[model samples]
Target: MNPTIQLEQQYLVHAYNRAPFVFTDGEGVWLQDDAGNRYLDLVAGIAVNALGYGDAELVQVMQAAASKPLHYSNLYHSQPMAQLAARLVQVTPFAERIHFQNSGTECNEAAIKFARKWARSHFGEGKTDIIAFSGAFHGRTMGALAATPRPKYQDPFRPLMPGVRLAEFNDPDSLAATIDDHVCAVIVEPVQGEGGIHPATPAFMSALRELCHRHNALLILDEVQCGVGRTGTFWAHETYGIMPDILCAAKPLAAGLPIGAVLTSGRVAEAIHPGDHGTTFAGGPFVTAVANVVVERVSQPAFLRHVSETGAYFQEKLQEINSPHIIEVRGKGLMLGVQLDMPTAPIIQAGYQHGLLLLNAGADVLRLIPPLIISRDEVDIAVERLTAILTKSA
Candidate 1:
C-alpha cells in the first residue's frame, strides 16, 4: 500500500473514496504526485480552483494578507472582509449584504436560516417551509442536507429539518405545485454539478422567479459550484434574465481557499439581527484578500468571454469524440459532464492510469470541471485521452 494511503486509512475517517495517487503539487492544469508522476487535472479540486494552481497574483495576495493577520474573530470588522464585500458588490449586481462562512455547506446553511428568519418576520412562523430542487446539492449540513432530495443521502439521517420540500429541476410547473404561501424560499442550483450536469432553462428560471414573487417566497440560487465565472457569467442566473433574492457563492470564490458567502438583498438582510448567524475563520484577511484577486479577474468581460468560448469549444470536442458509451454531453462553461451508458468507475480509474485526473458526479456521469484558465491545448489533451479510453473500452 502507498505510505500516504496507509496513513490516511489508519488515522482519518472513512468518509471519502479517495483516488489512488497522492498529488504533491500542481500548476496550471497539471498536477504531480509524490512519485514524480504528473497528470493532467480536469477536476480542478472539485471546482474550487478557478485559476488553476500556483497563480502568482493569488498567491501573493494570500501571503500578503497572512503577513498582516491570519485570523480574527467576527466581533471586529476586518479590512479584507470589507474590501471583498465591496468587490463582490462591484462585480455582481447583488451582494447588498453578505454572510461569510468557511465552505459551501456553511453558505447554504446561512441562506436557509436567513430565509426562515425573513419569513418569520414578514409572514409569521407559518411561512418557514423551504423548497429545493430534486437534483440540487446545496450542502451537507443538516439544514442544507434536508434541502437535498437524494434519498440515499437522506435516509440514514432521516427526519432532518421539518418543512423542507422538493421540486423538479427545470420544471416550472413542479415548482408551482410545490411552493405556496407556506414556503419561505426556493433554493436551486442553476447547474446541477454533483447530481450530473443539468442546466436550468430560461423558461424554468423565469417562471420560478415569477412564482416566487406571487407566493412571496425568496428565490435562493445555489451557485456554490457554478458561480464565480464557472458558467461564463458572474452568476448562472444572469443568463436567465432574473436575479435571485438570495445567492450562495463559494468553491472558486477564493480559488481553493475555504470561503463561502451568502449574498442577499437589503430586505432579506433586515430580517436577521446581530446574533442570528456568525462564524469564525470566515471572511478573514488571508482568504478574503485572495478572493479579492479572484473576483476582480474572473469578473472581467474578457476573462468571462474566454471561459464561455473555451467551454463551448471543449463541449464541441467532447461531442466530436463519438464514443458509443457516451450517452450525452451537458452543462455550461467549465462545469460539464459526460453521461455514459454504463457506470463511470472503470473509466474514471482508467483516466488516472492514463495520466489524467477526472471526477464522477455519481455513478454514470463523468464531471469535467476544470480550471477556468485551462487553455484550448489542455482541453484537447483531456479530450484525446478520454476518447482513447472510451474507444478502447468499446
Candidate 2:
C-alpha cells in the first residue's frame, strides 16, 4: 500500500473514498503520481482548474502574494479584495456589490440570508419561503442543503432549514405551480453539475426570471461548477439572456484556492449591511491576488473562444465513439456529461489503469470537464483512451 494512502486511511475522516495513487506533481493538464505515472486529466480538479496546473501568470501572482501579508479580517480593507470585487462587478452587469466566502456552500448560504432579509425588509413577515428545483445542487451546508433536495444527502440530516419548496427542474409549469407570494427566492443552476450535467432550457431560464419578477422573488443562480469559463462563457447564465439577482460562484475562482463569491444586484445588496454576514479567512489578500489573475485571464475573449471551439470539437468526438454503453451526451462547452448504460464506478476505476482521470456525475453519467486550455490533440487522445475503456467494459 502507498504510505500516504495508509496515513490517510488511518488519520483522516472516512468522508471521502479517494483514489489510491498520490499525485505529487502537475503541469498543464496532466498530473503525476508518486510512482511518476502521468495521467491525462479530464476532471480538471472537478472543474476547478480552468487554466490547468502550473499556470504561469497564476504562479507569478502567487509568488507575489506569498511575500506579502496573506490575511486581514473583513474588519479592515484589502487592496486585492477590493480590486477583485471591482473586476467582478465590472463583468457582472446586474451586480452592484460582492460578498466573499470560502466555498460554494457559503456563497449559497449568504445568498439565502440576503434574499430572506430583502424579503422581510420589503414584504414583511411570512415571505421567507425559498423554491429550489429537482436535480439541483446548491451546496451541503444546512441552508444550502435544504434547497439541494436529494434524499440521500438530505435524509441523513432531516428537519432541514424550513420554508424550502421543491419544483421540477426545466419544468416552468411546475415552478409556476409551486411558487407563491410566500416564496422569497428561486435558486437554480444554469447547468446542474452533480445532478448528471443537465442544462436548463432557455425557456425555463426565461420563465424563472419572469416568475421571480412577477412574485417579487429573488433569482439566485448557483454557477459554482459551470462558471468561470467552464461553459465557454465567463458565467453560464450569460447564455440564457437573463441576469440573476444573486449569483453564487466558486470552484475555479482562484484556480483551486478555497474561495467563493456572491454577486448581487443593487436591490439585494441594499439588504446586506455591515456585520450582517462575514467570514474570518475569506477575501484574504493572498487568494484574492491570485483570483485577480485568474479572472483577468479566463475572461479574455480569445480564451473564451478557445473553450467554445475546443468544447464543440470534443463533443463531436464523443458522439463519434461507437460505444453501446454511451446513452447520451449533454451539457455545454467543456462541462459535459456522458450518460451510460452501466454504472460508472467500474469504468472510473478502470480509467486509473489506462492513465486517465475521470469523474462520475451521478450513478452512470461520465463527467468530462477538462481544463479549458486543453488542445484538440489532447481531446483526440482522451477520446481514444475513452473508446478503449468503454470497449473493454462493454
Candidate 3:
C-alpha cells in the first residue's frame, strides 16, 4: 500500500469514502493530482469554491490579511467582522443582524435555536415544534441532523432533538398538512441539493411563506448550498418573490474558507438575549476579510446576471446532450443535476478516471456545482467530456 494512504487508513476514522488520489494544487476549474493528472473540478469542493481555486484576487486578499491578526476570540470587535456583517445585511434582504458560525451545520444550528427561542417568546413553549421537509439536508449536528430526518442519518442518533416534524418538499399540500400553529418554524432548502437537486416550485415557496405568516411562524430557508450566486441569484428565495425570516448560508461564502451565517429579520433577531447564542471563532479577521471580498464580488448585479446567463446556457447544453440514460436535468443557475436511471456511483468513479471530478446527490443524480466563475467555454469542455463518458457507459 502507498505509505501515505496506509497511514491515513490506520489513523483517520472511516467516515468518508474519499478518492485514492491526492490533489497537489488547483487553478480555476482544474486540479492537479499527485501523479500529474489534471481533472476538472465539477464539485468545487461541494460548492464551497465559488470563485474557483487559486484565484488571483482571493490570493491577494489572503496575502494582505496575513500581515494582520489571523484570529481573535468573538469577545472583541474586529474590522472585517463588522464590515462583513454590514455587507451581509446589505446584500441579504432577510438580515437585520448576522450571526457568524464556522460551518453550514453551525449556521443551521443557530437558526434552529433562534427559531425555538422566538417561538417560545412569541407564543409560549407549546409553539416550539420545528417543521422540516423530507429530502431536506440541513446539516449533521444533533439539531441539524434531527431536522434532516433521513433515517440513515437519524436512526443511529436516535432520540434526536424533539419537536422536529418532516413535511414533503415542493409539495404545498404536504407542508399544509404537517405545519400548524404549534410549529415555530418551517425550514426548507429553496433548491434541495443533496436530495437530488430538486428546485422548489414557485407555488410551493409562496405557499410556505403564506402558511408561516398565517400561523405567525418563522420561515427558515437553508440556503447553505443554493445561495451565494449558485442559483443565479444572491438568494434562491429571491427567484420565487418571497423572503425567509431566517436564512442560513455557508458554503462558498468565503470562496472555500469555513464560514457560515444566520441572516434574520428584526423579529427573529431581537427575540434573543445577549448570551443566548455565541461562537468562539466565527467572524474572525482572516475568514471575514476573505468573505468580505467574496461577498462583494458575488453580490454584484453584473456578476449575478452572468451566472444566470451561464447557468441557462449550461442547462440547455445538458438537455442537448441527446443521451438516453439522462432521465432529467433539473435545478437553477449553476446548481444542477443530471438524473439517470442507473446508479451514479459508477458514473462518478468513471468521472475520476476520465479526469472530471463529479459528485452524487443521491443514488441516481449526478450533481454538478462547478465554480461560479466558470465561463461558457469551460462549461462546454465539461459537457463534452461528460457526454463522451456517458456514451461509453451506455
TM-score top scorer:
2
Task: Quote the lDDT for 32 in model 2.
Answer: 98
Query: What RMSD does model 3 have?
Result: 1.0
Name the best candidate (by lDDT).
Answer: 2
Model 2 residue runs over 4 Å out of place are none
lDDT per model, in order?
A: 0.89, 0.94, 0.91
Q: For residues 258-292, what per-residue lDDT tens digits would candidate 2 score against the true structure?
A: 99999999999998888889889999999999899
Of candidates 3 and 1, the better by lDDT: 3
Error of 2 at 226 (Å): 0.8
Candidate 3 to truth, TM:
0.98
User: Residue 186 deviation, candidate 1, in Å?
Assistant: 0.4
Question: What is the descending lDDT order?
Answer: 2, 3, 1
